[model samples]
Target chain A: MLSNKKTTNEKEIQKLIEELDNIISKKENILEINLDEKIRKLAELLSSSNSLEEINNCSEAIQRLAVIIFEKTKALKNRSGILYIDPFLMKLAILGSNIEKLSKAFIQSWRPVVGRDVINLFLLKDAMTYWNSITKYSFEAREEKTIENVSKISFLDERGINEEIEEMYNELERRGGKELYDKLIESKNLSEKIFKAVILSFMITYGYVGIIREPLKGKVWVVKKEKTIESKNPESFVIVVK
Target chain B: MEEESTKKLRRAAQLLFFKSHRNPGIKGWELRKALGQDYTKILKKLEEKINELGLTIKIVSDSGELRTLSDPHEVLSNCRFFISINDPLTITDLRTSGWSIDEIAGLTVCIATIISKEGKTTRQELEQILSQKLPKWKATRLLSKYIKAGYLDEKEDYIVLGWRTKSEVDLENIIRYIFS
Candidate 1:
């Protein structure tokens, strides 16, 4: 009679396991399952059974049920304000619709925050005081050796620079209106080559010439600008004489 | 005494409406310092005053979620307060507020995607989802814009709903309207 009872208990535990699996794997709404009752039944079976296999199966089922319950509770907590819709269906709806319609749908549900930003007299006064304090301290000028060298270079004056740039622009135009930067600076004397590069930079800066540096091709070209466009924003780049 | 209370109410309104920080809205402590210890009471009065103009005050907790005034006094004091419209906005209103149609559509896709994924998704996943409806470049740009606008938060790789979304957007209604 005791042996017969053990067989019945084992069969019942197996049945419960199958049911729990079905509920977990097949049901869309986990809330519909009475997971608490299932857990209670598993506990009762676990205590009554002397057989090791039946006890193990019951414990495992209870653990799986407990995990599902925990997940459901967490999901519910996170979704306190929002409703749950199938993610796949939501993606379908979003992808199937046109932008205009989707935007209209979104606006129908959006409540934008509205606030004002004002600059009052106190704020303006505070700003003025801060500015005044900052302006009281001027930036100190630092003397560098480069400044002395630049000062000695008399040809760097703004007055005659424009005419020299014009002459270089004419020379570039005579040479097919476009010449390789390296070729333009090619000379036996290193000083002369450096001087020519300096002039080329001035021409590029004054908008009389444009430099096209193809870093990938390892080449630089100096193209004459058809019109003397004012270089309001000049970009600087280095060209190796070698 | 009535005149004093009225002045405090005006000060509270200014603090809530005028942005004094990088983020919109004023902290509860700042309000306390500016309007005295009875700042919550003043905010209650301000809520009533703004209600007439179809506007309302929103208090968000330090955790970046909306909180009711019924919370503990300490929690309430730590919360941030801002003004928001009482009613839902129309498309025309959004346009006037400087949001382009593509931007509105893109933001909707992003928010909905994040919510559907249990309130968090990856940046790459979001970008891929958005690229379906927009050019890859535009999709990337729009994602950054939404993040900057406080509609979405980025934590390393994950993208979660932001404080602005919590206070302003009706996530339930957005889902319902879209499915409907």
Candidate 2:
């Protein structure tokens, strides 16, 4: 009867050792194994063993089992939550030979979030109201000093057109034809300056004045033409009046 | 008073639907300032109203975790509120939204690999895994796109799931489907 009991204990120890081996080899999921049950069975076996060799064998199995449990518990404690992944499934799906199949599997499961940007009248109105409330400064209308109407200098009128051109030419000649274009057009009133610029353009157009621009120096010299000669090729250039 | 409440509800809906910040959601305090102190009640009403339209409002905590309305008002106030479709999109819908199969597959691989690695992995490791199926350059570019789109985040050398993934993707269900 004692021999029969010894054999049973030996068989149970062998089965437990095989289970532990499967877990250690990662053939079975560590999380799925009943660790507490294994420990209890091992404790029962240790208590029932008749020989010193059997006790020693049971203690060794228990020590190995304790180490496995300790490692697993430490890993679990480190994890924030239970995000379990089946190692076999991961290998088969992600590291599998067929990547297209993995993609299809993802497509089958993906549920993308749906949200769109939208603008509505209600939103616009709220925005406007918010803007109006926060904007404390009123746009004060300072009376823009009305450009005082200077006596009409009509360069376009045929009656005074020649007189205007001649006056501009004589002025250019008086200034030694080397007056900077800006100095010639400079006036206290903006309108008067613009008027002078317009007349200067006409003077250039009629061949009474020629502008030599030193682009590097950014200076324009209104050289008086020695003789009035109609421009064979009159290229239009812009003269901005400040 | 009824008219005032209706106007507040409209204002709340408009605030949520029209994104004003760099991100797609509005903060709880902004809603309170717009809709009044009873913003939580207003949000609840707005949530019900949107639910009928097959839309839903999701609240994400400041730490990027999803929160429900059942959370305390103070907690909800600190959270971000955004709207999304209640139902998942079909594959055809995904294609229509300009997602290619390869890109989808690549994203799946990244998300799955990250989850397997306890929600974090090194960028070099992820790239190596991706390079098996895709060209090295393509994998690198795809990872950048994912990071930019808030699907994955890069912290120094480590890559973790992004806020958008936490708000949108159902990780558990995705894993189950992959195995299935």
How do the residues B15-62 of candidate 1 rate in per-residue lDDT, one tens digit apiece?
Answer: 877766546777778888999877778888889888999888888775
Model 2 backbone overlap count: 0
Which stretches of model 1 miss by more than 4 angstroms?
A1-69, A76-82, A116-242
Clashing pairs in 1: none
Tens-place lDDT digits, model 2, residues A31-71: 55678889889989989988988988897798779778876
Per-residue lDDT of model 1, residues A162-241, tens digit only: 55566767778889888889887777886677767766776776577766543213467888777777643344454555
**Best candidate, lDDT:** 1
Expressed as tens digits, the lDDT of each residue in B57-173 for candidate 2 is 888885668898778878888787888777766666665867676787788888888888767898778788889889988788788777767778764347888777777677776
Winning model by DockQ: 1
TM-score of 2: 0.51
Clashes of each: 0, 0
TM-score of chain B of each: 0.94, 0.93
